[model samples]
Target: MESLVLTIPQVRKIVLEAAGLARKAQFGIGIEAVYRIIDHLGFVQLDTNYVVERAHHHVMAARIPDYQTEWLAELCEDGSIFEYFTSASGFLPMHDFRFTLPIKKAFKAQRKPLTQAETNLMKQILDRAEREESLTVGDFENDRVEASSGWWDWRLRAS
Candidate 1:
């Protein structure tokens, strides 16, 4: 008798159903985590496979939404999918799934720009601070010379 083989879509459906159940149960199961479980069960193969094939299988079986598919695809394509694994543990793949949303907020919020007076004041303060402390790395000998010129130099040298 021929062994029953499930197509990638069918396998993905099963995995996705399992993941949904996990989510409903608040089990925190992710697609990669599910993939690890499936891989351990010998239901899915992810070794040395073509990137496209791996991505397609992941997309079909992982239940990832269309909005997040592009990022997942990119992760797979860029070979970063493996980085999500914690160890050589086969279950690492299932925990690697992530979803990101593009934020549309303004880069700079609607706020009044700095007034010319404020800018000038800031510049003046910065200039004063810079002038007050011009950092310089002096040699140990030079530091000793400067220190010796101070009133406490004799006492410090005696110590």
Candidate 2:
């Protein structure tokens, strides 16, 4: 096998093209455009931040000329995209949800064992999710839980 030498311009173009942030996205192509962009990008991080706009929106704006703040939300709400942790919490193509399973498994394995209270709370949340086909902390308003526990720490492994 022969090694092909690449020039600076060639590498730069490849990086930019993959990032999509520096490329011209399909203008007026609508939200389907975000699907395509994140497909190529692997995942787009969502941040609870605003410095002009949220990070995901800002990232999209750099690539997509006709981006809307609601577009990414719509993708997730409609299940066209699902949430995953890729370095940071991000939205990814729904078809790619399975790809995050390995990450979830690894994350689960390293988790500290659940306390009895935590275990019961998790069961209540899981049960509610199954019954309602949706869940939020509001569903568990009556159940006392530690206020400081991070949402990402939900997958408490049983001992």
Candidate 3:
């Protein structure tokens, strides 16, 4: 039988290194570096608040010397990474997308079943997204009379 003990400093160093914060440029530079970092870390929380800069950008820039904010968008657009809720909202490597299925399932199970009208609205939104190639919440106006239902509710402007 054998056991190993770690000093406090040693444990702190280990945790920080695993989090990619033991030193600077841990993931190097450029968009490829961004992918590598996300793949290594598994998830990076995304924050839209920009008092100075977005939290996700700040996180990537701290470890990547040439990190650019646009790189995240580019990676997401190209399907190399994706943003979704997992404990918290964040970005995850595209390859890890399937691992989030359980979280999605749990969320759906806790919610009431969608009404037929809500289901129909969802189909309309999906169709619009397919036709438009891309869609954002702002793409639709707040014209729904049923009251904002949930996160997936898509508000459309009156035509």
Candidate 4:
């Protein structure tokens, strides 16, 4: 039997397609499955399996093709791939720091904590309503009670 060697790019394409299909159907594609395929294709290292798995998680988030292809391309162009890799897996260069941070402080400030008075008022109102009606108010804080208070006015509007 002839041995077949699969490159990182080829495996990445397959993983992306599979993930896309899974996403469309509202299902999850296991990371283990993707790594197993990579291992089967002899692209992963036997000693760096754990590192490869971690890198796979990072790579999947990158939405990039296989690590090897990217690494090779970087090497061909830049001559050195300075990154970490598991003994059983390929390398992910440290330079490709793709994680994005919230740049706009103003935008993040919009999600700031509510004022003490506002929070107390909301809690008091909700507590009174729950006590009077013996009703459960699930996650009122998370669901934004003030914003959703107008929902009750729908009945009055209809009448």
- For all predictions, the C-alpha RMSD in Å is 20.9, 7.4, 5.1, 18.1
- Candidate 2 lDDT tens digits, 45-148: 88875667778888777777777878877988998898887678888889998878998899899999989998997897788788899665444544336554
State the lDDT of candidate 1 residue by residue for 90-134, as single tens digits.
212433343211221232354578999989978966776678765
Worst 10 residues of 2 by lDDT: 135-144
Q: Cα lDDT of model 2 overall?
A: 0.76
Writing each residue's lDDT as its tens digit, candidate 4 over 24-98 gives 322223433333333333232223235435444444434323324343444425633323333333533333323
The estimated TM-scores of all candidates read 0.19, 0.63, 0.67, 0.20
* Local distance difference test, candidate 3: 0.87
Query: Best-fitting candidate, measured by TM-score?
Result: 3
Full-model lDDT for every candidate: 0.43, 0.76, 0.87, 0.43
For model 3, residues 27-52, the per-residue Cα lDDT tens digits are: 77799989988999999998865799
Q: How many residue pairs clash in each candidate?
A: 6, 0, 0, 8
On lDDT, who's better, 1 or 3? 3
Better of 2 and 4 by lDDT: 2
Indicate whether candidate 2 or candidate 4 has the larger TM-score. Answer: 2
Total residue pair clashes for candidate 2: 0
